[model samples]
Target: MSDASALRKVMAPTGVLRATINVGNPVLAGLDVEHQPFGVSVDLATLIAHRLEVELELQVVASAGEAVDVVSREEADMGFFALDPRRGESIEFTAPYVFIEGCYLVREDSPITAQEEVDRLGQRIVVGKGSAYDLYLSRTIEQAELVRAPTSPKVVAFFREHQLDIAAGVKQQLEVGIEEFGGMRLLPGHFMTIQQAMGVPKGRSPEAAAFLSAFIEEVKAQGEVARLLEKHGIKGASVAPSA
Candidate 1:
């Protein structure tokens, strides 16, 4: 088969490119005034579908975990996600197209003023269950206990509700939460820099994966990624360097 034919067969087996959009990650996606999914991820998915010459079907979900699950199970053909070693087991990720910061938010009265203080004994950090930060902290946190909120957008509220010591997630997300909830401050710097990328199920043909990898690099080099970020009014995230 020709390369184009192979790409379509593997990337859109159902004759439509179903892309999973995680609205929970406000930095990458969210519901607009009309409650429709719109953001950088949405734009990328649309572009991918156009390139594939297939109809675009967005499978919008409430959380990143849900997005990852659908793609890993082949329920969706592709997804955007924060690159994590744990998630890489089931998904083949292209080099990141964007880099976002993972930060810690704490109560104003709390003694913790630095990111380094967060991992100490007796500190309780609340994170969205199955989120990128949760997965990263789960593997790295040595002493502090992690409390899980139902979703990333709820992490700060859950932390306040439970009186946890800290809330952890995307810097933009935590900043928005602080404005809504009040009485919280982020640590001086980020704990981790999240690498956001496009992914397909590991079971897909290698040609499909290579196509996506090349697609990402092309978009980044051509400034489409930066343009999307600007169009969406996104802040605190940067286009990743070329792979």
Candidate 2:
């Protein structure tokens, strides 16, 4: 079979390429009033479908964990996510197409004035389960007790309800938390920098992964990623380097 035919067969076995999008990650995507997915991930999925000559379908989920579940079950052909080693176990990621900062948000009057101050003993840090920062903290946090919220947005509520010492998440998410909850302040430096990328289920044909990887590089090279970020008025996300 021709490479194009093989690509279509593997990427769209159902005749529709369902791309799972996590709108909770504001740096990558968002939902409209109608709850339709929008932003960079939407644009990328649309372009992928156009490139493959396949019908496009979106599996919109409330959080990244839900999107991860869709890909883990191989229910969706592809999804967008931050490149984390933990998620890589069941997902094959293309080179990252964008970068966003992960940081801590503390109450304005809290004693954790710096990022360094967060890991001290007795510090109670709340993070969303399965988020990029959650993965990072899972590996690095030793002394402080890490609290897990059901989702990223809920982390702030967890922090407030329990009076947790800190909340860790994407920088934009914490910024939104401040607007909604007040008394929240973001640390000056990033705990980590998340590399957002496209991913497919593990165990797919190597050639299939290669095709999507090359497509990602091509899109980044052609400046479509930059155009989308600017068009969306997204200030926190920057196009990732071509790999």
Candidate 3:
């Protein structure tokens, strides 16, 4: 089959490219005033669909884990996610198109004043279950316990409700949480930098995965990624360097 034909067959088998939009990652996606998904991820999905000559269908979900599930199960053609080894089991990710920070937030009166201080006994770090940070912390944290919030947007609320020692997630999200919840302060500096990429379910045509990687590099080189970040008013995240 021709390259175009193969790409279409693998990426839009149903004649529409279904892209999973994880609205829980506010830095990449969120609902607008009308509750329609709109953000950098949404725009990139549109671009990919247009390039494939197919209709675009956004499968919006409330959390990163749900997004991963939809894409991994092939219910969606593609998704945006942070680079994590556990998730790579079923998803083939492009080099990151964006980079975001994973940070820690704590109550002002709490004694956890430094990033290193978080990984101590009796400190419970609240994270969105199945999120990239959750997966990372699960594998790396040896002492502190993890309390899972239902979603990233709820991490702060979960932390507050449980009086957890730390709330962990996107720095931008944590900043918003501090404003909404009050009495919380982010530990100076972030713990990890999340590499955000577009990915397809494994077993799709290799040509399709190659196309996604090329698309990411092209957008980054052309400044389309930067434009999207600015257009969405996203702060504290930068376009990933070309792969």
Candidate 4:
């Protein structure tokens, strides 16, 4: 069988390229006025379907964990999310196509003026549950207290309600939501850069994963990724280096 045919079989077995879209990560995906998924992830999912010559089916979910779960269970063909050691165990990630800065936000009057300052014992940090920042900080943070929010869009709200020391999330997410939070300013430096990639469930055909990875590189080289980011007015997310 042709390589194209095999990829189609492995990636779109139901005759549709089913892609999980996470609207919880507002920088990547969000619900519009009518609450429909719209953002960078949606465009990438459509591109994958067009490349495969199949119907595009978006499986919209509220969180990255939900999106990854769909892919792991084979309920969706693939998903777009961050690449982390824990998630990599169950999914095969392609070359990252976007770099999102993860940073901490503190009240304007707060003494913490830098990223590293938040790591001290007794300081409280709130992060979205199951988010890339949450997973990373959970493992590496040894002194600071950690808290959870339902999603990235709500991290700031959680921080304010609990009167926490800092809130961690995608830089753009905090920027967009912080105006409602009076006197809140982002720390001068970021804690980490979330490497965002397209991935398929582990144990799927490697041929399909290879095709998707090559597609990411082609789009990055051809400027499609940059165009998409600009079109969405997405800031703080730089195009990632080719893998």
TM-score of each: 0.98, 0.97, 0.98, 0.96
Cα lDDT computed for each candidate against the true fold: 0.94, 0.88, 0.93, 0.89
Weakest lDDT window of 10 consecutive positions for candidate 3: 1-10
Worst lDDT 10-window in candidate 2: 203-212
Write one digit per residue (lDDT tens) for candidate 4, span 62-127: 888888888999899999989899998889999899999999899989998877788999999999
Per-residue lDDT value at 110 in model 1 = 94
Q: Which of the two candidates, 3 or 4, achieves a greater TM-score against the reference?
A: 3
Error of 2 at 80 (Å): 0.5
Give the per-residue lDDT digits (tens) of candidate 3, residues 149-239: 9999999999989878899999999999888868989899999999999999997888779999999999999999999999989989998
Encode model 2's per-residue lDDT on 81-150: one tens digit a residue: 8888889999999999999999898888887788888898988999898888888899999899999999
Name the TM-score of candidate 4. 0.96
Candidate 3, superposed: residue stretches over 4 Å from native: none
Clashing pairs in model 4, backbone N/Cα/C closer than 3 A? none
Cand. 3 Cα-lDDT: 0.93
Candidate 4 residue 193 C-alpha distance from true site, Å: 0.8
How big is the positional error of residue 239 in model 4, measured in Å on the Cα after superposition? 0.7
